[model samples]
Target: MLISMKIVIISSLFPPNSYGGAEQIACAEAEKLAREGNKVIVLTLKFDKGYACSTSDAKNLQIIEVSHKNIFNYYNIGKKSICLRFIWHIIDTFNFRLANDIAEILKRESPDIVTCHNIKGLSLLTPLKIKKLKIKNYAVVHDVSFYTPSGLIEWGKEKSWEHMGVLTRIYRFFTRRLMSYPEKIFFPSRWLLDFYYKNGFFINQEKLYKPNELGFVCENKSVDSGGKVANNFLYVGKIEHHKGILLLLDAFERLKPTNVTLDIIGNGVLMSEVKKHAQTNPNIKIHGQISREKLPEFYRNAKAVIVPSVVYENAPNVVYEALSCGVPVIVARIGGACEPIIEGKNGYIFNPGDVDDLVEKMKKYL
Candidate 1:
């Protein structure tokens, strides 16, 4: 059966103004829908007024950039203290200007389905507005941002700390209870939905797991070690403590596999630390930030991609990209990192934050 639908895709960040995995998935899904004969409109935040609050129809997609300046960026918050960053996180969610812009669009478009991806930069009230308009609303939980300010559940902390802060508690109430009230909600992986459920989310609402759709696909993917390289382990994401980079470094240093090498890509606050380690270690290569066009080459030329995230990641796009190139993954046993990997088949999973466990998993390729 052929169906034509009006779909309003809402995300806080879009491509060319990337935030992370959420933007990549949102943009790709929206474009895919537009190509499938649906009338699609993408609502995303635009910090620069020069972009304008106008519509552009290209490749069968309509993009509406809502004009709003984020307080964190306006103050240049890189390398700032945790307290200051938390303040920014609070302000980012309770945005009223972006809300008005989206609400007005909803009124005019009156789309059949209001599909929301990430609403951190915009406002969580987006789905509420959609419901108010009596439209079928769907939301995708690509992150734990609704529960925690940084979307990270710190490792080794007691669960008590999760609801310790008043701001976090309030945010959780809205995100966990109110936001989950959408007509339907999607999780990219079972681990993600389970994580939310274990934390008391999805109260009296519909939820399901839908694997993230990748932007590209490689043909003739094989289970054999048929990638371009045999002994190269790759890590593509932020270099941060909560991401388990420090633990990975320590594990790699202590393990010291004689025949294999490790490659680190992307940027973050821990650049200096990674650079220092790269200076001391010859096997560890720091590529900084590589262009998107050059990413596949890296994935193809690697034995396996390492996702050592200690936080509760939803479904990392790196894993999808790696799989698309027929490269296996060695993932941490937390969050969605372990969801895609099939032990002894496609990839291996090790206890998160456990150096010895990671070393054992890495040795399989080494």
Candidate 2:
């Protein structure tokens, strides 16, 4: 018989304040564990505009939002300047105050295990606190944030280890010790796991390439003949430079298919540029970010999905979500984005930032 155990899940963000896939994945794990008769306690940062604590619909689930004393909240980082961001990273690297807050919570709850995900905003030294308290600790790598604060190095512009910038070298120096405190570390992609290994991380911990759960249930909408509801291609993710949103837009424009339409979802720094492009092109439509409940409808209505990230994306949620809906994917041949795809099979892969290569892949679906 399986005994119910208390599990503490620590994430930087959760639903209602979630900006990306990592948060959703964390929420899904917590809810699933709760459903299985485990006492799941989720500790996350309290954003300025969000509730102090989240009320969950799942039984045995409790959420406690703690304030991380910092220059600014993590969610609104895009609005801050480079100098503020640099200071934030410095404070986050060795935030003993926030670590004490986490220690107090752990002392009160005294859970069986502590699992951390995306702990940049919440504090990277959290594992160190957990270690000192003799808690069984596990961690999930959602991105390259531990090595580089930006969580990205452009697709082809990645630097060699010795040639890395001072920021990354310094960040990794601290994180390398902090990361060792975890008993085990989970990675969503083998490529990402290897990247960390090459960068000399998690040498003393058990590393597993465990893909993320889709987080939502969606009926296979592409059950019909040809598996397409319309001539629409969907892009659902952050509109950031490393996401290759501009590359996607440029490729789509160059293709200039009259019968096909492109629908963009989500919001970010490049939102204005996307809007400008949409204004000039009737075939392009920008719906901005929508509720997760409504994402299936968009996936169902789309002929295909595109993930054109220029960064080392570790198994993006969109790839799994689109596949679950039976929608084919066309992704950049970088990072783990193309790991789930088999050329000319369920989806296609193109060279990252190569507009012509992307157009060629899109032509197959069109």
Candidate 3:
């Protein structure tokens, strides 16, 4: 008399659609659970790019793609004032019709447990509908901002004051009230849990579960260590100030290594500034948005992958990616990024914005 649970994963993003930290975690966890003999299916939004639509079963996991149009896709929005963000939230949360469609799917499929990742893009309304349908549900909070509005404001990008404003506050207040409908809340890091606790989001800490590292089994690939004499460092994330791209560049400039080069492999609002900086310094190279498939190649060839984020990240997949590829990581000692690093064992860590410390750390590896 063992009970087998049918789990439905509701995430805003999924593999081959978009590659974000939360999406990766959802993908990995679903695969793991499926491998463990539990029926796992993913309900995710399909981007307009129309890359691949066919679904294939592997490792006992199934992925269902619900097509989505990019109307209020705030994933691209860099930063905005509190007022503008509040308005965006209203439009994003209410105007979208995806929730109704998702609710229909939930009614049809009737999964025993529903696990949600990022619902901002998909609209929280859908989950509410699932609750009305009396479905057992759970949510994984990948970032602190989901619980509190003012989480990442200090990143020097467009701020979402509106989401942190009066309207958002009202919405959050109600949302917190409805949060108890879910049986459990999963957090990738303790920092996120503590942030929510201090902000008065969850009363009982028992609801929070760590689930630290996602299941990431690296596929065996040929490694090529031989190349040109130029020593290289790698950065693999959005080109934003909060990611500490500017800080990394500033530190690289200060270090002034004649033979070392830094390769930036993502795109964002700071692209123009990063491009301008790269123009002045031939040592810095911006490769703008590389596909997820191509990321392993970058990690395989680099001296070390750098994750210099200024904000409190829940858990960065890049750190795991670097480790999986057998490449070392140099990260900032803030948030969940420090969870994997052993402070010189497998990787190195530096103060969040300390250019001098970063320079010194870079010198050790180079």
Identify the runs in model 2 with alpha carbons over 4 angstroms from their true place.
1-3, 50-56, 160-163, 215-229
Model 2, 78-111: lDDT tens per residue? 7888789889989988888998999999999999
* Candidate scoring better on lDDT of 1 and 3: 1
- Candidate 3 residue pairs that clash: 79-158, 80-158, 82-161, 82-162, 86-162
How well is each residue in 64-162 modelled by candidate 1, as lDDT tens digits? 877555554421344677787777666666666667678889899888888888877676666666777788988898877776766778656636565
**Model number with the top TM-score:** 2
Q: For model 2, which pairs clash?
A: none
lDDT computed for candidate 3: 0.73
C-alpha lDDT of residue 74 in model 3: 45
Give, for candidate 2, the lowest lDDT window spanning 10 residues: 220-229
Tell me model 1's lDDT, rounded to 2 decimals.
0.76
lDDT of 3 by residue, 63-110 (tens): 777755434444433366666666666655564477778888888888
Reference-based TM-score of each model: 0.88, 0.95, 0.82
Point out where model 1 deviates above 4 Å: 1-3, 48-58, 73-94, 158-163, 219-229
What candidate 3 gets wrong by more than 4 Å, as runs, is 1-5, 35-38, 46-71, 74-84, 91-98, 148-151, 155-168, 211-224, 227-230
Ranking by lDDT: 2, 1, 3
